[model samples]
Target: MHDVVIVGAGPAGLTAAMYCARGGKKTLVLGNTYSSQQSMGGLYENYPGFPDGIQGIELSERMLAQAQKFGAENQTEQVEKIVPLSNFFRLKTENWQYEARTVILAMGAGHRPLGVPGEKELTARGVSYCVHCDGALFRNKAVVVAGYGNGAARAVLYLANIAGKVHLLCTREKLVAESVYLERIKNLSNYTATFGAEITEIQGDDFVTAVGYKVGNTPRTVKADGVFVEMGMKPNADLAIALGLEMTPGGYVKVNRLNQETSMPGVYAAGDLTGGRLQVATAVGSGASAGISALQYLG
Candidate 1:
């Protein structure tokens, strides 16, 4: 049995593996190609210490190399289920089963689709979810913030300070997020709020030039450099639920704050699956905590 098995290859999982290996534990990281960090395009500027910033793929590669240098093994496989045994946890992959003394879940969150025509085709060209990662691309330009939750409100507040104008759109009649966030966003003069609207189409050839939405009986369109979809994300918590770990009402795994310890004694969680601001830096930090906790559990 391995000392630890990390269930992702994102920043969080890689950081956990590095810490575990450095702590003298044998570590195995299992992940599928589809879940790799390369899918997130553009340069990450807020990752600290990078003045000019680094590409997401480059940052991920650096982390992966660092983990490998510490002797952590990686496997490209989708874990099917996890079964806890007498003395170890059994990780059942699609092709086989392996055992480990401890496990860390850092699979992160899944993006929500806008479900509008031309959205998939114009993803990088004009659609994005991360404001810190892509907000600079639209500096002094008009952008659309779609949603009314905390993420949407936060994005609108941030964009209002940078972008020339911000259009905050929501399908719901009233904001469903925290009252404080709504109050902050409403005070911005550059931000305009639209309610009970649903985007019908994202139009542009090879890029997004404008967005079409309907409010009540009227259709409206806005010219924008890009559209930020702040509709929130779905956490990858199936394995945690399968292993009988407790989850919050939002479907994220419940964990102790500092150590990132889950309900299960030998299992832990970090990153977006545990819920918070979904940032790479926070992911790595939480992963470090989970790794240290797992090491202590093993000891």
Candidate 2:
């Protein structure tokens, strides 16, 4: 039996593995780190210690290497279920089952898709969910931000600096971003916001060339090189739910902010799974907290 078994291999899981292994615990990390949403991000300028910024995939690799160097074992397997036993937890995967004294759930959130035609076909080509990842690729080209709320407004602001022009199509009556973001968006000369607009389709041959939408009863098409869908994200909490862990109304695992401990004993959750700002820095911090708490629990 291992001392700690962390499900998920994103930044939070990797960081927890590094700490747990360094603390002399037998740590095992399940799932592929490269498959995380963090890895989908192209370049990260917000993460600290990287003056020149780092690619999301490169950062994930470094985290995995660091954890492995500290004696944490890793397996790329999808966990089917998690069973809480008398004093330990049993994690069942397709190939194997693991018993651990402590468990950390770091399964990240999945992006809510636009569900528009051509979006799937032109994903990497020009359609992206993360503006920070693909906005730079559309430099000097017009792009469309589809959705409302703070995420959509922030995406528009971020893309406005990189893309030649930014068009925001909001299904809501008005943009629902923070006042600061809304104010900044208004100052951008190349940014245009269309309220009460619904995206009908994403059109492109090999890449996204235009976005089809409707404003009220009028249909419209905007020329663009890229489309950013920022509707939001949904936490991946199937295992947590199955294990009977307490969760927020938004479907994220509920954990103590101090120690990242879940409602169930010996179970913890961190990162996007615990809700809050879904950023690499926050994930790393929370993972560290969970690792330390698990180590303390083992003692």
Instruction: Go through the candidates in order and give each one's C-alpha lDDT.
Output: 0.85, 0.91
What does candidate 2 score on TM? 0.79
- On a 0 to 100 scale, what is the lDDT of residue 49 in model 1? 83
Best by lDDT: 2
For each candidate, give its TM-score against the true structure.
Answer: 0.71, 0.79
What clash pairs does model 1 have?
Answer: none
Q: Each model's number of backbone clashes?
A: 0, 0
TM for candidate 1 is 0.71
Runs of candidate 2 exceeding 4 Å displacement: 115-143, 148-167, 171-196, 200-210, 223-226
Instruction: Quantify how close model 2 is to the true structure by its C-alpha RMSD in Å.
Output: 3.8
lDDT of 2 by residue, 1-299 (tens): 99999999999999999999999999999999978988876667679999998988999999999999999999999999998889999999999999999999999998889888898999999999888767789999999898888778878888888999998888799888779777888789998878899889999999889999998879999999999998888899999999999989888999999999999999999999999988899999999999999999999
